[model samples]
Target: MNPLVSVIIPVHNGAHFLPDSLASVFAQEYRPIEVIVADDGSTDGSAEVAESFPGVRCLRLEKGGVSRARNLAVAASAGEWLAFLDADDRWFPRKLTEQVALGEACPEAGLVLCRVIHRFSVDIPEWFYGPTDGSAVTAYEPSAWLVRRAVFERVGGFDEARSLGEDTQWLSRAWDLGISHLVAEEIGLERHIHGANATGLIQNRRVVFDILRESVERKRARRAIR
Candidate 1:
């Protein structure tokens, strides 16, 4: 039997790109899925755009943070697999279909990540990171991964305190938990570059990355002790 997948998209003033993101989700060939839009106090028309989507459960929250928004969405989701997609990024039509197929092939693998193609206005960059034999991949976008819901619950949801780098931090923790498995595929995801995105802001707020580094080091230290 195919596993149910919950697609969680956390939006913070993502109105401009929300429609495209939602459309990508709707186009997924995979069935038995629910789309949850966790809106984190969008002052823009994000809420309105999200509400326009039929059957998409929109969980509105105070202006906490993206991690908080993601946690709220995860709590409301009822899928065995959690597939997260940033509002500004989109998947190919075969994204979910191919990911779930990979999951089925290796039932023991807790995480599966695909290759990504970066699309800027000027040019398109083909990026691939994995072993030559395709053992595992290094560095992955959150949009490229399909993780087991239980693994997320056990490791705890995204760190609510961290202002940025939450996706990388969470994936690192997952890797530390000895549940990481990767499958390299050309059916890639497209990462859109835009001004409103959080990447620049995250770098500006160096303190967030500092916090993330400390947490990661501490996790490693604890593991070393055992």
Candidate 2:
């Protein structure tokens, strides 16, 4: 029997792109999967849009940021595997299927990452983009991850203190634990580059730098311990 996989989506005022994101998950070629959309105090109709889809579970929170929203969703989910997708991004049709196969093939791998195709909502300078040569990207995005629930729990989920870079912080913890991960060569997600993307905001750059500093300190501490 295939293991149950839970797809977690956290959204805030994401009504415009929620439908397409949810549709991609529902179109997955895998079975015994559950989708949970955590509404992070969306004034928009994000929750309603989530509910409109049959079999999709919607959880509402009081604007506690994406980290808290995801943690709550995971706490409520009943799946051996956890897959994350942002409301503005989408998964390829065979995403879950391929990830499951990778999980089975490498039973020791707690996490599986796949390639992502960035779909820009507006034209941007070419210099701003990274190499799109289908190579395995070094950076980790939440939407491209398929992690085991055990690993997620072991890492203590996303850090609630971080309003941004929570995924990076969580993955850093996973790496420190020496958790094994496999990277699938195929593209698994389409990351939409739009104006509202938190990463694109200038003010968030400071948060990014802070996350990097903390990560460096943590790594150094770990090395000293060893």
Candidate 3:
């Protein structure tokens, strides 16, 4: 039997998209996996949408934020591996199969990430996704990751203080700690860049930069100590 994977989804007022996202996860259907939805205090029927799917554990939280929701869900999870999915994004049919294959092949790796397809509508600003057309192949999304539970614990939960780019901070910190990672060549996830998405908001982008700067300074300070 394959190892179990805990799929953690953080949702807030995402009723309109939960069905599709949940459907995508169930479509994988190739391995023993548990689905967990951390509902971040959504009043727009998001919890109901998540519950409609059989076997999905929905944790209704007090709108603390996505970071907090993820930490809480992880605390409740019982799998050796963890995969994160946002309510607005989805996974490809073979997302788990490919990730698990790579994980088993590289047992030493604590993290695995796959290429992603970013979809954007015409309303999104041209600067938001420069040079690339409607589709862009990118990395660094938490949704594209299949990380080990131990590695996640060592890195600690996401920075609850941050409302944006918490994933960036978490991944950066993991890398700084020298956690081994494996990359899957397949495009295993699709991130829909609707204008309402946080990454599209200019203010949120600033927060991402701040997180990056902090990571860089941490690295520099560590090098100085060496």
Which one is best on lDDT? 3
Candidate 1 lDDT tens digits, 14-71? 8988999999999888888899999999999787898899979898888999899999
CA RMSD of each candidate after superposition: 4.7, 2.3, 2.1
Off by over 4 Å in 1: 121-139, 202-225
| Model 3 lDDT tens row, 12-31 | 99999899899999999558
For candidate 2, write residues 1-226 as lDDT tens digits: 9999999999999999999999999999999899999999999989999999999999988999999999999999999999999999998899899988999899899999987777777665333455544444533789988999988989888998878778877877888778999988777888887756766553546766776687789889978999
Clashes of each: 0, 0, 0
Q: Report the candidate with higher lDDT, 2 versus 3.
A: 3
lDDT of 2: 0.87
Which residue ranges in model 2 land beyond 4 Å of their true spot? 125-127, 132-139, 202-204, 220-226
Q: Arrange candidates by TM-score, highest first: which order?
A: 3, 2, 1
Instruction: Show the lowest summed lDDT stretch of 10 residues, model 1.
Output: 122-131
Q: TM-scores, in order shown?
A: 0.85, 0.91, 0.91
Alpha-carbon lDDT, every model: 0.79, 0.87, 0.87
Winner of 1 and 3 under TM-score: 3
Residue 28 of model 1, lDDT score: 86
